[model samples]
Target: MSLEVLAVDDSRTMRDMIRFALEPAGFTVHTAEDGVHGTEVLDAIDPDVIITDINMPRMDGFGFIDAVRDRGQYKATPILVLTTEAAPEMKMRARNAGATGWIVKPFDPVKLVKALQMVAG
Candidate 1:
């Protein structure tokens, strides 16, 4: 089956970038402007994987993850935090909050695709 991925970020450019990279990797990507929007997409799509940013206008990535984890249907889903924040504490919080992995922004597109493939597959 084709992989379905939800990419959540406030920046349109960032969402486009992820879609550009991952679409070629055989993923069907859907985007959300922020956590609230992301939650809506989750309900509509039930995507196989989620990639999100830390800072967003409406509920942040942490809140997004928390909401997903709180829901029984999404509790075991794979989530990857793709953000500009690379601090150890940020990674720790993401890990504790149920994210499967964390990736720093300004990331190499090739590497990012590979990592997403590894995680989403």
Candidate 2:
């Protein structure tokens, strides 16, 4: 089955890249500009996985993860942090916020898809 994905990032290029990577792999992609917008998008789609950037206006990835976990239906949903930051502390923070995994920026499309399958499949 095709996995549905929601990608939240402030950079339009990043969102586009994610779409390009995932779509051809047979994954359905949805995008949001920031955490707040991500939350809004979440209300409309029942995605199997979510990929979000750490830096954004209105709300960041941590806040986005927290918000997603707050919803009962999405409490166990897999949230993956996809960002440029590779700091251990940041990864810990995302883990604490209920993220399923973390991926550094400029990710390999194959690895990204593998991670999603491992977490959400």
TM-score of each: 0.95, 0.98
Whole-model lDDT per candidate: 0.90, 0.95
* Residue-wise C-alpha lDDT for candidate 1, range 11-113, written one tens digit per residue: 9999999999888878899999999999998888988889999999879999999998998988878999999998999999999999999888887889977
Candidate 2 vs. true structure, TM-score = 0.98
Clashing pairs in 1: none
Model 2 ranges with Cα > 4 A deviation: none
lDDT of 2 by residue, 26-111 (tens): 99999999999999999899999999999999999899999999999998899999999999999999999999999999999999
The candidate scoring highest on lDDT is 2
TM-score of 1: 0.95
In lDDT terms, how accurate is model 1?
Answer: 0.90
